[model samples]
Target chain A: MNKTIINRLLVNRNNNHLFKRTYSSVGNKIPRDPKYAVINSKDIDYFRSILKDPNQILTDKDDVDPFNCDWMKKFKGNSQLVVKPKTTEQVSKILSYCNEKKIAVVPQGGNTGLVGGSVPVHDEIILSLANMSKVESFDPITGVVTVQAGCILENIENYLVPLGYTVPIDLGAKGSCQIGGNASTNAGGIRLLRYGSLHGSILGVEAVLADGTVLDCLSTLRKDNTGYDLKQLFIGSEGTLGVITKLSFITPPKPTSVNVALFSCHSFDRVQQVLIRAKKQLGDILSAFEFMDRPCIDLVLKHQAGTREPFDDSTPFYVLMETSGFNEVHDGEKLSSFLESIMGDELIVDGSVATDSKNMTSFWKLRETITESLGKEGATYKYDLSLPIDQFYQLVAVMREKLDGKALVYGFGHVGDGNLHLNISTPNQSYSKDMLDMIEPFVYEYTSKHRGSISAEHGIGAMKSQHLHFSKSDPAIHLMKSIKHAMDPNNILNPYKVLPQ
Target chain B: MKIFVPVKRVIDYAAKIRVRPDKSGVDTNGVRMSTNPFDEIAIEEAVRLKEKGIAKEVVAITMGPKASEEVLRSSLAIGADQGVIVNTDKPLNPLSVAKLLQKLAETEKPNLIIMGKQAIDDDCNQTAQMLAGLLKWPQATFASKIEISESKDSVKVTREIDGGLETLSMKLPAIISCDLRLNEPRYAKLANIMKAKKVQLTTKTPEDLGVQLNENLKIVSVEEPAKRSGGSKVTTVDDIVASLKKHSLI
Candidate 1:
C-alpha cells in the first residue's frame, strides 16, 4: 500500500528481461528487460537504412522530445532514436533487426493517448506510424475503408464525408489521434453508446509481430465468424503484442439529423431518471447522454472561450442528450416531447435544445472541450472508469471525501455507456506524491469492490498495468500473460507494458 | 413563385487540385468533386423558399458531360423538385451557358431564376447578368439576402458591395444571384440522397434542345501553386522571444 513495499514488490517482478533506466518523470524506474539490447548508434544506422528516409529517423534532442512524451506530458521517455516506417515491409525489416539484436521498440501512432502507452518507458527504439498514413482501399458502397494504421481520425472522417459514411469512433482527440491508436487502445468516445465498441465495429487488423512475422487478418467483410476472433486480441492490447500496420473496418453512415439538448439535473439520481426516460422515449434517436457536475460546467464556461452556460440557471448536474433520426420534424418533435416530460417530471431543472445547426455545434462545445479546459485550470489526476449506471457517482463522492477539500474533484463522462472520467484538480499546479498515494489503490479498490473496470476505454498502459489484476481475474491475466509471451517471446514489441512486470 | 437554380460541378474546395504534367489544365483525375460552394448556397436558398411555402417548386439544371449529372442529383438530394441536365461535350463559356439557360428560361418559364453569383472554379461573375440580358428580365446580383414579396410579383434582394449594402427590388422572372452570406447549406441525409437518386433527372442533348455551346475564352495552361515549406519551430516561448529580439523585431 505504501512506496517502500510497492517498490520492493516491483523489484521482484518476474519480467523475462529487466534493465533500469536512469531517469523518469514519475520518479520510478521502468522495469526494462536486461535481455533487450540497449539502443546504440549502430541501431540508428540500421534503422535509417531500412526506413530509407533520414528524416524519418529523429535523433535530435528537440525532435525526439515530442515522441518521448505522452499527451498529458505526465510521462517522458529518454529514447534517443525514433524510427518512422512508411511501409509494412519497412516495419518488418526494422522489427526483424530489432528482434535479432534484442532491441526494444514502442510502436507509436498519433501519440495522443491520455495514458503513457505510445512513448517508450526506457531506452526502447520508438517505431512511429506517422509515415504509414494512406487510404489503402475504400469501398464507397459498403462503407468499409481500408487505411494504413497512421491515418488521423479526422482525415478519415473527412475522407468519408462524400461517401455518406463516417468513422464510428469520435473523440476529443480525433483531430490528432490515429485510427490505429484508437484501435490499439480501444478508445471509447461519446459515440460508443451509439456505434458500439470498436471490437464489433473493427473488422480486421494487419500487424507485424515481435519477430518480423506479418499477421494479416485484414478482412473487410461485415460478417466473418470464422474461428476465434483473433483480431479482438490486438484491439485493446496497447501495442504490446505487435505493431498495428493496417486496419480494414466498416464505417457507419453519417447520421443525417443530429439534435443536442443541454439540461441541468438536480442530482445524479435525477440524471439517471432522465437517461432512462430519454432511452425509452427517444429510443433509437438518442445517441449521446453525457452528464457533468456544476463545477465542471462552471470551469468549462469560465476557462473555455466562447462557451456559455447552456441553461439560464445552474443545477447540481447537467446532461447533454443527442438524438439522430431521418425525419427532422419528427425527430425534433420526439426530442421536444422527451425534454418536456423530463422537465415536467422535475427530473431536469433547466434545459436548452439546439434548434438550428449553429446552436447544435455551440452546445456540443460545452461538453466536448472539457478536457482542454480542465488542463488550463491546474493539475488533473484523470481517471476513466466504468461502473454501473447507479454506482457512477459513488466513486466520485468517495474520492472527494478522501481528498478532503485538498483538491477540486469532479466527474463527467459518457454516462449512457457507464464510463466516468473522474478528475481531481490538484491545488498545486503539478502532482505531488502525497496526492497520488491517496488517490490510487483506493480508487482501483473501490472500483474493484463495485466490480467495475479500472481502465475503461483507455487500455492498461504503464500507468495502470500494476492494478490490472483488480479488474481481470488471476486465471484470465495468466492467460493474457501467456498470450503476450507467445506473441512476443523475446519481450521486444513494447516491453514494460500491458502485462504487469 | 417557381424557382430555377442552375448549379455547377466543380472540384471540392477541400481538395488541393494538382496540375497535370502536360500543364494543359488542372488534373481532375481521381480528384474529389462537389457542387460549386456558392451554387450550394443558391440551392439552399431555393430549398428554404420551398420549405417556407414561398416557392411552389424548385427545379435545378446543369450543362456539361455525363459527370455533371452528379451535381444536379446533389441539388435534388438537398431539395429540388426536378433536375435537368443539358448534355454537351464542348467547353461552355459564361456567354454560351447564359444562352443555353435563356433557352431553358423561355421554355420552363420559371418566375425566378436563383443561382450563384459566380462559380468558384472560374470566379467569372457574368452568367447571371448575361442570362438576365438575354431574357430581357430584371436582375439582382451578389445577393446576400432575398425576400420574396407576398404579392408574388417581385423580390427585394439585399446585395453586398464594396461601398455598403445595396437593396434592390426586381420584378418577377428576374435572375437573382446569391452570394456567400445567403445561408449555410445543410448536410443532406442518407435518406434524402436515396430519395434524390430516385428523383427523376431528365437528360437532354444540346442538339435536342437546339442550343449550341462554344468556348469563347481559352485557358492557356494551369500550374499548381508553389508548395510552402514548414517554418522552423521554436522549442519554447522564451526561444521565440529570444529569436525575435535577435532579429530586432521585438
Candidate 2:
C-alpha cells in the first residue's frame, strides 16, 4: 500500500520531468529543488494578523538571519517569511494555506542543531514553533510531561529538577536545543547510556502533516503496541515526516547520589580496560563514560591554562566517568573498589573522585571543556562518529599514524554509548584541505568497516551529507527519501539535508 | 469582533546584556525589562481597533512571572478588553507556551489572537507556529497589513517575506503575529494607569498546566560572546572604498 502511494508520487514526478538526472555523483537524485517566490509585504502583513496578533511575526532580514542557520554555520539558506503560530489550529490553517499556494513550509525548533535540519535550505516559508512553547500537561504521579515541541531543553530540565524529576537525556546543547528538534533528530546526548533513546521515552508526538492535518498522538503511555507505531516514524524522520508540535514524554527520577571521577591512562589499551571495569563494577549506576586522548588534554591545558589534570606527567589518554546511585557511599565504595581491582592491571595510572556536588561538577568540567578547547587548537576538523567501543580508540591511533605529523589528531568517546569525537587540527591554512579530505574519508571508512555510524549525535547537515552512505544503507537511504517524498513531495522541508543532493 | 493579544516580557531590546562570570546566565542586574516590542504593537493594534469600534473588545494575556504584569498593565493601559496572565516562573519554550495559550483560547474562544512574532529571549520562534498546529487555526505571520472582512468572520492579510510579499485570506478565529511594520505601539498614559491597576490578571504554574520541566538539557555555562577589538572606522566614501578594496570585500 505504501509502495503504491510512492509509485503514484513517482509517476507525478516523471510526468513533469521535474527530476534532474545529474545528481552530482554523490548519492540520491536531485528532484528539482522547490522553487519559492517571495511573499509580498501586504500579504505578509495579512498572514501576520491571522495569528493571535500581527505583532509576533519576524520578517526583517536582520531579525531573521539568526533563525536561518543552525549552530554549525555550515548550511545557510534564504527564507522570505517567518510565521509563529500560537496554537495547533493556527499551524494547521497556516500550512493548509501554504500548501494551497505551493509555498513550502520549513518547521524550525531551537536553531542550535548541529545539522541544518532546523533551518531553511531554500526561499521557503519558515514556520517557527517559538510561540508554541507552553506546558500543556504534567502528571507527576505517572512521571509524564507533555509540552509543545519548541520548549528549550534546559528550561524543561530546570523545571523538572526542582520537582524531583529530570529530563532523562542531557547534552551540551541542551540550553539551545528545543524539545521538538531533540525528538526530531532523535538526539543521543551524553546521558544516553542511562536514559536510552527517545523511541522509548517519548510517549507520543503531535505533528502537523503536509496537508495541514494534525496527527494527534500525544499519549503518555509507556506501551501502546499499536499497529504501525506512527509516532515512532516521526521521531527520527528529521522533520521530513511532519512538523512536531507537541510531545508527551516520560521523565526519570532524579538521582539522589552523583559521583564524577577523572582518570589518566598511559595507553589506549588501558583506557578500554578501565572502561570495561568501570561498567562492570558500576553496572546500571554508571551514567557517563567519556574518553579523551593526549592531544585533546594538551589542547585543553594550552587553551585553558588554569585547568589541570591530576597526573604529574602528560598521559596518552584520559577517562572521565560518572555514576549516580541511590546511596552516595555505596556508589563511592563501588567506584573505589573498581579502581583498586584495576590497580593491579595498571589500567589507571592516576585518578581523582569528587567528594561533594561542587567537586563532582569541577571534575566534569574537563570533559565539557573539550568543545571550547578545540576552538583554540588551530584550524580544526571535527567528526562525531559512533563505532564499536573497542575499535574507537584504535581508529584514532590509525588516523594519527596516517597524518604522520602533518596534523595533530585527538580522540574522545562516550564509551558507554559508542559515540566518539575525533578532532584533527592543521597548523596552518596550507594543510587545511589536505587534513579535511584525508581525515574525513579515512575516519568514515573505518567507522563503516566496524558497522559504526558516521553521525553519532551531530546530524548529517550539509557538512556530512556527502558521506551519508558511510552510515546509511541504500535501502535505508531509499526509504528515507520515500518518507521525505511522502510528506514533502515538493521536496521543500530543509532541502539538501540528511539526504544527499 | 473581539481580539485576544498575547504579550511577553523580555530583556529591553536596547540593553547590552552581560553574562555572569559564574556562567549561569546573563546578569539581570541593571538590565532594563520591557514588553517585547512586537507584543506591545499587538496590544496597541487590538486596542486601536477597539477604540475605533471595529473590535468589540480587546483582551490581553501574558505568560510569565508576576513581574510580567508590568507589560500586561501596559496592554491594559492601552485599552485591552481585559487581561489574563499565566503566572509561572518556569522558562517556557514554544511548545509549552503554545499549549498553555491554546488552553486559554479554548476557554475564551476569541475571534482572533495576536502576539509578537517571536520572544527576544530564547528566540526559538516556535510558539506561533506550534500554537497554530495545536489549535488548528490559520495564521498570518510578519503581517504588514490586516483587513477584517465585511462579514467580520474572515480576514485578508499581507505578510512580509524575503525580497517580496505574500497575500493570504482565512476565516475568522485566526491568529496574527505582529512585526515592526505593523504599527508604532504607544506608551501607557497616567489616565489609563488607574484603569490598568484594577485589571485582573490570571496566573498558572507548570503544575497548573500539568507539565514539569525537562532537566536533561542543563546549562553548563552562559559565557558572554567574545568581544571584538575596535576596527579602524572608515567614515568618508573614499576611505570606505579603500578599506573595502583592501579587505577584498568589494
Task: Find the candidate with the highest lDDT and give its number.
Answer: 1
lDDT of 2 by residue, A6-121 (tens): 01100010111222111122223234354644577766766776785764688889888767754434345677678888888888887777766667667888776654667776
Top candidate on DockQ is 1
Task: Give the TM-score of candidate 1 (chain A).
Answer: 0.94
Give Cα distance to truth, residue A319, candidate 2, Å.
Answer: 0.7
TM-score for each model: 0.67, 0.61
Off by over 4 Å in 2: A1-34, A376-379, A427-435, B1-250
Task: Fill in the DockQ of model 2.
Answer: 0.01
lDDT of 1 by residue, B1-250 (tens): 7899999988756454567898877877645466887888999999999999999999999988998887887788778889999888788899988988888888889999999999877789999999999999999999999999988898999999999999999889899999989997764533355456667788887777777666568888888778898777897999999989988998
Tens digits of per-residue lDDT for model 1, A1-501: 001101110011121111122113443546766787887778787777787768889999899987987756666787988888889999999999988999889999988777788888988888999998898888988888999999988788778866768788888777778999999999998788888999988999999999998999999989988999888888989999888999998888766566667778778999999988988999988888998888888887886666665655668898888886666658857875776677667786766654333445656777777777776665678888999887999898888888889898989999999999998986335656677778888899999999999888888787887888999999999999999989888888777877778
Model 1 residue A162 lDDT score = 63
Question: How many angstroms is residue A439 displaced in model 1 relative to the true structure, after the best TM-score fit?
Answer: 0.6
For model 1 the local lDDT of residue B120 reads: 77
